[model samples]
Target: MDFVPLWAVVIDYILGVVMWTLIGRFGMGLFLPENTSFFFMRFFVQATDPLIRLFRPITPGFLDARFVPLFVAWFFYMARFYLMPWLLGYSVMGMLSFPLEGEIARGLANILYKFQN
Candidate 1:
């Protein structure tokens, strides 16, 4: 199998994680009240709030502010699922085409091994 370069592997991993966080934050909003004191929920809110705020002003007047998470999630979804892969010279086949967790782990292991040797 062809090895993915370390930079691509790292970037893909980070993008996937951030995109997943945005999705989770959006999903949590659907059921939990935003003011809930749960720890993970609070962390998710704190983490994604800036992105939501960035998109807030462009939000349509008819759409409620609570829905901003969904829009921010969509933005990260597009960046992770489409833009990153395209920039990396891969066809846009969604997450399946991105680097796997194991691949990133292996790449990091290889880099560390080389540095030590």
Candidate 2:
């Protein structure tokens, strides 16, 4: 009775990655311009450009270019945090809704607890 659908996990993980990538891009953009030649900045731009373009139709013109990554990331976060759980018939975001971050947090906590003891 504790099983969650594999499809649900995959979708949650995919959305999680996109959300983090967008967040990372936003964080990097704060200190680096879009035209920077640095590999990491370039990689963020390359990875998230398609997503930004996909959401341009819904993105507000009033928002600044530097904020687009975060704006896009919010949608993914919303879908993962709310939609997935609802779709899975969960009243809250349980493990199924946040498998990626949830497991990572749990693993880190265990590691820290062991170290502390």
Candidate 3:
């Protein structure tokens, strides 16, 4: 149940990282070349386009092209690392019971609590 959503998020993040690495290192045309079949690029375009499109507006043109993928990757990582635990803790006894969620929450809590103490 919850694992599905968690895995989806993880997979999305991994895809984002891979796409970003490939494009940043090899250039966009490598994935979306004009001379080849359209089908090959479909998955690459779909997975990377949504995030790039969403961020393009707010980001300056100079920075937008280079930073969009990195920003999206960081955003996904933060969502998994910070928001998930906070939301789960806020909902359930200030403690997460699920193993994965619980581990993340405890690790983050320990880090924050250490700074406080």
Candidate 4:
């Protein structure tokens, strides 16, 4: 296997962790009010704020500012499912798309597939 694809897979895992954290932060916000003093909430906000800011201008105005996390998550989803594979010269559908489960499973599967051949 090429190093480029392996590097892409590592990035995929990192994106998965960040994407899920963004989703969790958004979901938690629905129940708990924002308080910087709170640990998890603060961590979530600090962790995801930069990413949200990076995407905010491009995200549709119709989307409320509070939905920035979701918007960024969508961007990551697109990168993982579409952009990465395209860059690697593979069709989007040819690679495992869902990132919530982490990349270990996919990486292991790739190793096993290579061994099988």
Say which prediction, candidate 3 or candidate 4, comes out ahead on lDDT.
4
Model 2 over residues 1-75: C-alpha lDDT tens digits? 148788888888899999999999999999999889999999999999999999999999999999999999999
Between prediction 1 and prediction 2, which has the larger lDDT? 2
lDDT of 4 by residue, 1-117 (tens): 344556777778887888888897887777676575778988888898888878767988888656778778877777778877777787545374544464467888899999999
Q: What number of clashing residue pairs does each candidate have, in the order they appear?
A: 0, 0, 0, 0
For residues 1-117, what per-residue lDDT tens digits would candidate 1 score against the true structure?
255567766777777777778778878888887789988789889998887777877777787656777766667667766776666676654633556555667899999999999
Tens digit of lDDT per residue, candidate 3, span 90-111? 5544232334444567899999
C-alpha lDDT (0 to 100) for residue 15 of candidate 2: 95
| Alpha-carbon shift of residue 76 in model 1 (angstroms) | 1.5
Error of 1 at 71 (Å): 1.5
Q: What value does the lDDT take at residue 102 in candidate 2? A: 76
Residue 115, candidate 2: Cα error in Å is 2.4
2 versus 3: better lDDT goes to? 2
Using TM-score as the yardstick, the better of models 1 and 4 is 4
Clashes of 3: 0
TM-score of 3: 0.42
What's the TM for model 4? Answer: 0.72
Least accurate 10 contiguous residues by lDDT in model 1: 92-101
Top TM-score prediction, candidate number: 2
